[model samples]
Target: MVTSQSTESRPSLDYEAVIGLEVHAQLETESKMFCSCSSGYVNSPPNTHVCPVCLGMPGVLPVINRKAIEYTIMTGLALNCTIAEQTKFDRKNYPYPDLMKGYQISQFDQPLCSQGWLTIQVDGVDRKIRLNRVHLEEDTARLVHKDGPDGERYSQVDVNRSGTALMEVVGEPDLRSAEEARLYLVKLRTILQYLGVSTGNMEEGSFRCDANISIRPVGSQDLNTKVEVKNMNSFRAVYRALNYELERQIRALNEGERIVQETRGWVEAKGITVSQRSKEYANDYRFFPEPDLPPMVIDRAWVKEIRDRLPELPDARLARFISQYGLAPNDAVVLVNSKPMADFFEECVALTGDSPKVEPGQRARAVGTWMLGDFSKLLNAQGMEIRESKVSAEALSEMLGLIDNKTLSGKMAKGVFEEMFDTGKSPGRIVKEKGLLQMTDSTEISGAVAQALESNPDAVSDFLSGKEQALTFLVGQVMKATRGRANPAMVNSLLRKQLESRK
Candidate 1:
């Protein structure tokens, strides 16, 4: 929370806000957490993917999915958490229509991972946001509200999402602003995607976030009454929600209104948070150990094996992109943001051989430029991802090679690349088929220069009068005559020679 500075005659008001996020990331396991039902329930028919165990039928024992546990460990390790030597499940008792099991089987006192921290940079300054715990739990069913005939409101249950392997990452209340919170979520999503654990798609509800926000006096260490904000399905929504909450709290305090502890849902359509219910404390959930599950001991060797297999994370890869490829830090950041984009860049560089004729660093820069420039532009315009594009790394590298060796003009290469992007044709074949080969012949350029000098006497006179821009106009005319196939450097030299010879 922040307060407006007041005049010296008036009392100055200032405050600080504490924000913590509990993010639930659905694990990319094929089966549900405690059942064998298919986890691929997106767009599926209602209740089509449920099982007796997931539906809370009696007399069925639950068996945990091993892959889900491995994913949890991988996620925890990636976030710099310490794995517990012993962990087990607890029954979190809460009666909700969405929860099939009257109670949710989640970790309570002993979670799988604890004491982790994630680093996020804001305004070029890095901050380490600590993690309180990372625990595993099962997702509940989805409720769909519908409007019936005569304008009656009805509710439907969709158990297809029930029993999915959902893992929670609880962060400490260290975030100061909405921007910081957004960065934290973005970095966390990147790590999860890099580890190949979760898709991190919020639109489909695969990744969800709940924010705990409170505001206190600027220097006070005592915690203030906090509000839990939910229904923020996207990163933008989360930022907006927190900002709205901050302003709301400040306004309340200024008007002598008390900030009540409650649960609120972000009405995205309205761009405001509306109160939903009184906030539930820990005692409201009545947590106890699950009698059906057994506590298991985690061996040190197993944890070490997972640690050894962790992939090179985003921060490390960004550094390598700068040092190994000689890329600027800004370019490196854009390239390494997405794993696919980073992979595509490396593949293109590998295809451009390290021959004495061409420097690898130059090639890397070329590939990065195209990727961040025209390639990105076309992808955005067409609403397609790099992985979904028709152009392959081999084809793009080949196109760059053509421009490097003067086989194609830079302008011609752009057209050839566009064709390759659309038709998946080889750059060589496209250039050949379109007759777009660079015109480096001095004779052809000499004729175009003569035509331009004769046609634009004003520009030629201007050049002779020491107007340097006149020379550029002559070169543009020559390039246009050749349909942009003429080498620009050759055009410039030829145009200058003809003009100077006349003078």
Candidate 2:
């Protein structure tokens, strides 16, 4: 059996690390935050999706996007944050090429949401990670650096991504280990996907994270110098970066070196973090209220409407899968991790009549097995998601129905499934086309069984001499003779009857 690695196995480190994450999720809004430019500029040429307000042209009055605010409020409510009755945007002044207007429109003293918490389970134990705030801000333009013809480095600014709606989720320093940090991010992404505000695709740059990690002595409450790690594009990168940072900080303290507060970038190829620059304090941004946009006044009815529209989240869905379907907790977790995959699984189950004739627990177990087993393997091999798979949910349900009704044996179904996954054919059609149905006909199976007994008399003698395993060997011979299409239980019964008759 497999086991989880235990922390106690390693040498105990006297210090503990405090970790907090700032996740920025680009909203799925069509237009720019303050202008009419399209935000869907992924593959479009740089600078094509620009306008007066987004391009930092002078005297352009900025207007807020209503859908952006509603999305932020919806996410805030999903995170259990309190919506501020009065909130407004502020100017965060910074000098960077990405900041088109020499500043970013963000929130300061009055953010739209505050004081929410999310619960994460680590090592089978539940822990609540507090949220400091969930705020909204306009995204900056992307900076593309390339090498010139002579190997000289030059940077180009693409304003196509400028002024996009970006929501920031700031978490408390509640995480202690890298595993907990990963779990927190995964849970956060699931929530965002369910909210449908963001795609939560890290590789596509829609969802990004910056981690602030600091190591301190155990049982001490005082904070220490923290380094912010950035440019982690995936969950694995984030986990590895944090763990590497933890080791680096712990080693520095052991060598009598002081830690410095700075911003670092994750070097994925080097498997380490390199210091980029000194970390900036909040005052450095020089935040001030935005003059052009008016303050937002949210009312009770608005909050209630958004809250009522909230769909079921991961935790609740996990519980329902366990209690209603009688699935194991771990199985429920895998099913509920991805919203689309979970929906597909449910659709397959619904098509099977949920196996009404069979035991509900048995039927649920079978469905979960196929999903987490061969189906998952195929998806991984092709590097595609369930929605992208050639086999539809209806096709898989038909295959499972055949197994439940004994129309196809388990071994035969495996081959039929492979054909379906490759050819996008229905399970029934593949079975019929390939003549892969089980040999339930007594006459066909009996002929194969008699031939096996005649050729394997030595094995039959062993069975009579009280070797119970000899019976299994003879049964395998019969299955092999029938090309694995024979009903295994019937073959075993016939083999026993023929051997007893020889006595």
> Against the true structure, what is every candidate's RMSD?
2.2, 3.5
**All candidates' TM-scores?**
0.94, 0.94
Tell how far residue 367 is off in model 2, in angstroms.
1.7
- Which lDDT tens digits does candidate 1 get at residues 1-503? 47844444546578777899999999999999999999998878899998899999998889999888889998899999999999999999998889988999999999999999999877777899999999999999999999999899988999988899999999999898888899899888889988988999888888899999998778788778999999999999999999999888877776668998888999999999999965355448889999998886878898889889989898899899999999998899888878889999999999987757788998999899999999999999997889999999999998998998899887998888889888999999998898888998989888988998999999999999999998888888888899998999988888888888988
Clashing pairs in 1: 1-17
In terms of lDDT, model 1 sits at 0.90
TM-score of 1: 0.94
Evaluate model 2: give its lDDT: 0.88
What is the Å distance of residue 357 in model 2 from its true position? 1.6
All models: lDDT? 0.90, 0.88
Off by over 4 Å in 1: 1-16, 217-222, 277-283
